[model samples]
Target: MTDSTSISLPADQRRREFIGGAKATFPLIVGAIPFGIIFGTLAEPSGLSAVGALAMSIIVFAGSSQFIVLGLLAAGAALPVIIATTFVVNLRHILYAANLVPKVRHLPQRWRILMAFGLTDETFAAVSSRYLQQEDIREAHWFYLGSFCAMYGNWVLCTAIGVALGEIFPDMTQWGLDFAMSVTFIGMVMPYLKNKPMWAAVIVAGAMAIATAALPHKLGLIIAALSGVAVGLSLQMLLTQTNTHSPAPDKEPQ
Candidate 1:
């Protein structure tokens, strides 16, 4: 499946799709730069070496968890504690990655895994929408690569910027850039809120997150995400069954 997914796109089409997708999603990465910088700058204060700080961005390639890791390191948390927290902080990514796997299943395993790692909210939002709409796995792969490249580039570059000049900004909180993450999420989710099922999922997830806020180790986010996914899936399944079982209103009685 992996090889087949990538084989559909001709070489030239693949290149074109890659470039186009990259251009389309480039601005999103630009918007996310400040958040990356803020994370990097805070890394020094977290007591991690510059190498380790930068390495996390390159290898872990996740923004929120990297920041959390830095803080945990600064607090002198135990190694297991740090790993566990980072894993929890990143659990939402499983949702991102699982959704994308089918679209790129034709690619080879190595490519599939690499692409999976590159998956993030912004890139997945951009690439998956196009992939699902077109049903062109290779083009979707190209789009994913483009979106991922743009995001990956910005993250690496911005981390360097944050580390080198973060002190100049003084306070990331003061600049109001933190709102960008919230705004990014809104931009991604709002467009898909035209239906009741989706709206229900959003409401359920948010309510759960708020309700679980007091749970230890910031477990609320996990609960919220799980609740959101489960509610959405369960509701969808019930609706499917209801539709399948019920007679059509247009047909009426024979």
Candidate 2:
């Protein structure tokens, strides 16, 4: 009895952590549903079959990249061009991985690989928030797994629904469901703008995105992201140097 109890304790704790992670991600999941459905609805008109659309959701599982690919296909882009464009668009994941390295560095190779596969914008936002607040690190990956599974399952399911609706309605995409995702992105970003550097990065990125909106193959987004990162880093360094060089105030008499 004692041995069985001991063996079950850690498993129970992990289950709780996983459930907690999924619960925390529920709101974000709500925001992504319409986006996923929209992608499904657009896929067929953009030259993809229903099976292909569902497969992309299950295999590629990247909403933005999938949408870009659909547009490129509709435009009759070359295969290499489509591949290159998606690669450039996904470069932001590198920065996300950099921010998360220290937290997951101690994990084994298999664990790290699984986490990398599951990393998405929503998962990153949800998991990073949990990591920041939670003191215990031992079971955190369970929480990550939970969030990943919830989002992944939701996306695939929503894609299927959209595909069905596409056949039935044939005008579902015209309803403007993509706007929900834009609002969801804003919700994700607003919480992180607690400092000057963050604010500057967002403002610069937004302005640059608009200014360069006509660039081909979505290169404007990459340029805007890079510009924002550069400005933020430069300002952070300058502020650190200024604080280091400034003289201290005189103390009161001891």
Candidate number with greatest TM-score: 2
lDDT winner:
2
Per-residue alpha-carbon lDDT of model 2 for 1-254, expressed as tens digits?
36898999999999998998898788889999999998888889999999999999999999999999999999999999999999988888888899889989888999999889888999999888988897888889999999999999999999999999888988988898878899888988898898899899999999999999999778898899999999998998989999999999999999
Q: Kindly list the per-residue Cα lDDT of model 1 for residues 110-208, writing each as its tens digit.
A: 888878788788887888678757754655677778788889989988888888776676566467677777777788888778766788889999999
How does each model score on lDDT?
Answer: 0.80, 0.91
Candidate 1 has which clashing residue pairs, if any?
1-105, 1-106, 2-105, 2-106, 2-107, 3-106, 5-106
Candidate 1: minimum summed lDDT over ten consecutive residues — where?
131-140
Question: What residue runs in model 2 are displaced by over 4 Å at the alpha carbon?
Answer: 1-7
lDDT of 2: 0.91
The TM-scores, one per candidate, come to 0.88, 0.93
